[model samples]
Target: MKRNNFHTHVFRCGHAVGDEERMVQAAIENGLVELGFSCHIPMPRYRRHLLKGTIEERSINNIPSFIRKLILGGPNMRMPYSQRHIHLKEVQRVKEKYKDEIQIFQGFEAEYFEDYQDYYQELLDSNTVEYLILGHHFDRSSINERYYGRAILEDKDVLKYASQVVQALETNLYSYVCHPDLFMIGKRTWSPACQEATTQICKKAKELSIPLELNSGGIRRGLREIEGVVNYPYPYDEFWKIASEIGNDVVLGIDAHFPNNFKEENYQNLELFAKRFSLHVIENFTFRKGKSNK
Candidate 1:
């Protein structure tokens, strides 16, 4: 029972309290070998001016309205902290300090958009990033353009979305698809066509030997949508069924955006999914080479 966690986040993305060094200590104490930090990428277009304050001290409502404004403005807006000095120094410091104690790979939880294809291509081409995790923050180009945690994928958009996902997956650029089933939940119903499209995408992933993630955060958030007998969020049954049928490799992503989120209940539930699906658990799969020692 190796303890490895690949999908994780840091303070820069917003929720977690402690920074990378503290997280590494927790991971070591918890008997983890690999603990990746896939923070949200810097989208300069999305970065709006905000009143700076400590995330822990700031009121949720009073935190800032910039996120909403940026979302409303569309994807062209760059990511917050794209050029922010503080974040740059923080990431560098973490990497330098923890270089010997834990594995710390540079990564991003990428947003899926038609425009994202180009942006991600640039990212992949850079060769600086070790892993890419596709987290569908928005379903379509139109509508609210908001970053709702719930999946809002429609049947008609399924093919296109699936195609973009396939491209992202097959590119051999991404390490895993974070919260891969976000679209299956939400207001849009999954149709026969959508399922078929997904099946194709799964097949492609299987061929590429890319791992599809079974995210626990969605389940923890109590956002599971009921579709037939399979639960939403990760859609374990449907997802596992397809993966098993296609022999697709599966990864369990806790998506632990917060420190307190790494708990027993959710870990047990995720393990149950692995057992139910007979999926391999790649615990302690460190992306950073030297970090697991200390």
Candidate 2:
């Protein structure tokens, strides 16, 4: 239970309280030795609909230009300002501030959707990024273009999207696959066919030495229905059964969007579930600083 937490989020990616110092303080208070800050990389462009969703929100009202530029990508969509020197400065500041207390690493949760392989490779090759994690919330490559909200709308594109996930994992570039169980909530129900597909993916993950995430964040703050009902990300029994059958590696990600979101109470239920299945805890993983030990 006492170990490092490597998948913390930061404020730049729409988090309300993911400031560097605040994150470090939270880790220290939690007695974590190795804390990693993995902010979401700015998407090539925020989807247009997202602009309508939060443009009038009070907190981001002051920096409307910044947020708009983020969506528009302005003149630098390919190499935007989000990937500029500011990230380096912030990482350096955090490292210097918490030198001995915690080993802070610079990382980004990159979206490995379609047409992003080169850009992601550039980021990985830039040498500034210490880790690369996958956040495949909405399949960017799916031909159907259905977002998480419409996951239950079955289509052949679903298979293509799932295969794309396998292809991305084939690259062996991700530190961890973020939220693999994310959209299972909206599935019609646990089906043998779905379980078979998941088993196949897990088999590949195991072969490629990639760790599939057990994301607490998905369970904690799930997508809401038009009727205001909250949907859990995955059924615990289904996940355990599939994982046990596949025998793939697993890692715990708090997927914390807000500060103090990974506290004992927040993670307790999932932790208990993981313990019951004997899933691997990623905190004990020892990499070569940057390169994965696998």
Candidate 3:
């Protein structure tokens, strides 16, 4: 089977470690056939600053407060317009250097905010980014919107998240949905509401023929144990079970934030999880460049 990981990050994403060259070398050494860099796209400066303040204020008594702060306040976490050009240049150079060894792709893990729709379009129009993966970290691009980590898994929140996923798929901008079950990050239990939300997401993905990613980053972070049950929010077995039932196209994303994360064991774990859930894992999905933005 072909080995590929489309969801990856680099030092540009502030919170992640390593550089693009280091990540590429690691992928080749780890026996991967293809590796795509989907670093976080920069949000507006004002929005980022506001989010940083909010995270700092609420981080006072939070467990993993340092991580939360890093995620929220890390400088250059997202690639601004000027920075993206440099990032793309570096990726192109690396791709040329390793062209014979392994395939390298340039892309971004972007948020689907209607307000920032034009920004994504501009990126696509520039013809520098090869693809975009929708990873909804927030309901909206605005600072006022609730972050997924802080979001309550109420019926309304679930519906809102699912609806956003549907809208994102409709845009046809994303190559796949990264961490489709990410809303379950802070969620303790797999409620009926969670199942319903995932069902809706799976149905839409199946209909659109867009692959949904089973991210391995959650596993690396450790599982959330609730009521004596251990589970990862993104790879939440219940979610993938529903996805399998719906017959949605699935892919394994390492979501590699560090160089060493692209390992054989991680791949084996992802494949094992897919098998347990009865998901049809696609190993060699083609990524075409200069595809229409709309």
Candidate 4:
């Protein structure tokens, strides 16, 4: 299969390293045919959203960021809204500069926030990005207690992840689902409840003809024993097992936070995971059109 990655991120997102040009250059050096920048989508009036909730909404480790949000209201979880324009402009410049070497795309890895639904549509309608991928990191709101990765530990939240993922897919705004098993990062036990939740996401993606991404970001954490089975936090074995049974299309996402994340090791691990579960991993995706296309 031709090498490509559509889940790339950069320093503007506040949790990543490297810049757009550096990542694009890295992709070219790695012999990738295509590279898509999918940094976290910046929200309008992000500071207001931060202020709407109390500090209790933030996790203990994120206290320093909470303080940053309170005063500076600059990039933390996502790029500050003010930085969005500059990020887009820079990507355009790099895409043009690297056009002869590789295909570069602009995209955002977005969560399903009800308040920003219209804004998301606007982004698509205006051709602000080439595509969007559903990376449902948080629940309800971006800075909430119901984080899918860190806070979820029970069936209710995992089920919520499934329900909301289905809802995000129904909108037809996302090209693919990034880390459908992100809930597994928090709830590791492969219990009946976990199976049920995974089943929901797999079945719906199969129905929508949307591809589920086996994210390499989780693999960066390395293997650990979850219920005595050593594995990466996501591309979670049991989750992909259900997805395999459902015969859903799967894609490999580097989920690149740094330029080096595009290295062959991550892709190899993603392939190994796919082979382990007999996942039908596809190499390309369809970019869903926004409401404005109507």
Over 4 Å off, model 1: 15-17, 47-68, 71-79, 83-85, 114-127, 139-143, 146-153, 187-190, 223-232, 283-294
Index of the highest-TM-score prediction: 4
**Clashes in model 3: which pairs?**
none
TM-score of the candidate numbered 4?
Answer: 0.94
Among residues 3 or more apart in sequence or in different chains, the pairs in candidate 2 whose N, CA or C atoms overlap within 3 Å are none
Cα-lDDT of candidate 3: 0.78
lDDT of 4 at 84: 88
Candidate number achieving the greatest lDDT relative to the actual structure: 4
In order of appearance, the predictions have TM-scores of 0.74, 0.77, 0.86, 0.94
TM-score of 3: 0.86
lDDT of 1 by residue, 241-274 (tens): 7676777667777776666566656677888877
> What C-alpha lDDT does candidate 4 achieve relative to the native structure?
0.85
Instruction: Enumerate clash totals for all models, in the order shown.
Output: 16, 0, 0, 0
lDDT of 1 at 14: 46
Off by over 4 Å in 2: 43-80, 141-146, 149-158, 222-231, 285-294
Residue-level lDDT of model 4, residues 212-282, one tens digit each, is: 99999889888889557987888788888889999999989999888898888879988988998899989
